[model samples]
Target: MAFREMFSKNHRTTDAAPPASTETGRDDTSFYDLKHKIHGRLIEETNLAALDSMDPAEIKTEVGGVVEYFLQEEQALLNEEEKRQLIVEVLNELMGLGPIEPFLKDPTISDILCNTYKDIFVERFGLLEKTSARFIDNAHLMNIIDRIISRVGRRIDESSPMVDARLPDGSRVNAIIPPLAIDGPILSIRRFAVNPLKMQDLVNYRTLTPQIAEFLAGCVKAKLNIMISGGTGAGKTTLLNILSGFIPANERIVTIEDSAELQMQQPHVVRLETRPASIEGTGTVTQRDLVRNSLRMRPDRIIIGEVRGAESFDMLQAMNTGHEGSLTTIHANTPRDSLTRLESMILMTGTNLPESAMRFMLSSALDLIIQSTRLTDGTRKVTAISEVVGMEGEVITLQDIFVFEKKGVDKDGKVLGRFMATGIRPKFADRLELAGIEVPEDLFSIDRYYE
Candidate 1:
């Protein structure tokens, strides 16, 4: 009688149970268990090594088996369509990223930055925003990273914990793991658009006004040595790509970069990318290596992605020698500072050239400096277009043809700025005239110019 009363009390308590945190915990455990099972089976039946070697279609064939197994196992627990949906979830977790596939497919997302497991962000429409996607854990994240690098025949390990790679879609990737990244693994992906931006797109986006665009087009046509300067993520490469479109399509264009990112519209273009040192610390091809080799390629125009180190000296020499109309990008804050940065970078070459000699070389090789800035509103615009008139004694003389005057921000937090002519006509106008390029006579007139 006592045992029956105890059982009856227990049954009554279960029927009147309060909200159970354990129930929520059990649900999470079940989800993880299903994911783990799918992950294990994917590794087993997929012939992990062969899967690594297979083409995308073959890999998907293996992935389909894992998906079918997952559907079969979950069918009784879920309705027909729900089981089908679960199959997608399992395949996403096993074969590739599940819910984040759409974001990866979206061409507008130029970058995907992950600060942590939960704090994912993407750059879209030239702006960064937090994304609602994540990897299950660090292991899953590492697997994806490793898969990408392996396909490119690269490696990362304790001895070399950092890697730079490009995705099949031409997105540049830099990843660093633990000892170097104390917080967690960090990945920075810079996406490249398959379609190169046309000059009109730049004008429509207000990167530069139409008048400025016309002026730059004339400069390119006239074979002016141009240096584009900007800070990190300042859209230097994009601007360089657009400027390259100004080159006559028939000219033989050669491009050198640490990684091949520029997509020029020119017909006869050759691109060279640097290679890192191999595991034995031998057989490395650097930007300087390719820059020196590019000289022998008989290039009509040579464009370096960015002159960051000793290669600046080589680039300057190329420009000074017969490589007119050459273009490149450099990291700097202002037009004047760009000259200083060039000098500093050239000094890195250990040439031991006197500072005055370096200044003279730069003043002659670089005819114009275009300074670009990413404003507080995340808009990148060319702030100044300055002319290098040649060295004034020890100093490089500069004249600003166009200046961006900040008119402050609007109610929407967007920057308001105007590009105004500084009333100084470039001395290179004579060269343009000789090239049969017509410069608007009113371009130099203050009254006739539009602000």
Candidate 2:
């Protein structure tokens, strides 16, 4: 069966968003300042627990009363429409993170960035667009940051100037303050899907073709060790999650990540996340720690969100020792750079192993390297899928099985490219066959290309 036919049934999530506000003129500094003040008064007067249980309609009615009284007392001139906008802002502050709540709810927005109180930007459709969202001041931004981190059992203060957290919805968050941030608090959120992307969605977006997806699904079934390589925001984790969908549901997969972003749907999967150091500068758990411990858990497959540090050695150890269908992602501009980074990370363990020995070990463990790239035009594509054909001397060898050939840009500035087979049959084709998966000759035909 095709990749979509197999997995598309359970991959559904609501892609719809409630109607966005078309309200104008309220996106100014003065309006945010007044909204902040009224929110302060509402906090003092209104019962937060009661409001939390109230629906949006009830909350609107309750907030309208408090906001109207404050508007009258402060003599802030506003018409009915402006009052309604002000009420929404106040409710946002009370109910969720101020100014950013709307962007968090936006399905099209992949990232939410706060440079400072005076400036905020969001990544919409792989491009950064500045939003009119603002906090009253740096303190207000810091307060929002604190609320976010606190919910995750993490904190940010003068003693510890940086933190990594996630929202209630599992979006990745990073925040830095004064000494580290220099200007003001810097906040970044990496959003994931409420309903994760499926193979059909990737094919629809042209990230990959059905042929490539079918081949990757076969690789997963054959228990090939796969590493996804890409630069930042290149959809590495998203591909990881999609590839993970190909794993047999009966396997007890163990996933490790610093921020815990992978949404594995397998029934028997075990998810693990690293813990940051406490305020006392102790009680911290690293990815390396989890990788070492996951061994005792008898995982059928080990899925790492990414291998960036000394943990690379342990991850390689797991791959070499019966954890065959393991998957991981790494930050590199290309497939070759991923091996280089892995070698450096292994050396980080201070092991005196020779370079050739390490290369041999890496070559033996990895089966394929899939490269994901975000084009200049904000579209993401799987640029290359290379197979490790083992070492041919001191160096680990890699060959491209499939690649995306970029053919410049269109008049509308969208990227134009074709995903083509390299015509070279991978060594793992035999393994797929042995696993009862067919190896179609046309899958490796170089003459045919997908647009």
- lDDT of model 2 at residue 383? 97
What is the total number of backbone clashes in candidate 1? 0
Q: Write the per-residue lDDT of candidate 2 for residues 18-93, one digit (tens) a residue.
A: 2333334244337877787777766654455565466777767766775775565566677788888888888788
What's the TM-score of every candidate structure?
0.85, 0.92
Q: List pairs with backbone clashes in candidate 2.
A: none
Residues forming the 10-long window of minimal summed lDDT in candidate 2:
1-10
**Candidate with the greatest TM-score versus the true structure:** 2
Q: Considering summed lDDT, which 10 consecutive residues are worst modelled in model 1? A: 1-10
Provide the lDDT at 193 for model 1: 77
The C-alpha local distance difference test score for the whole of candidate 1 amounts to 0.77
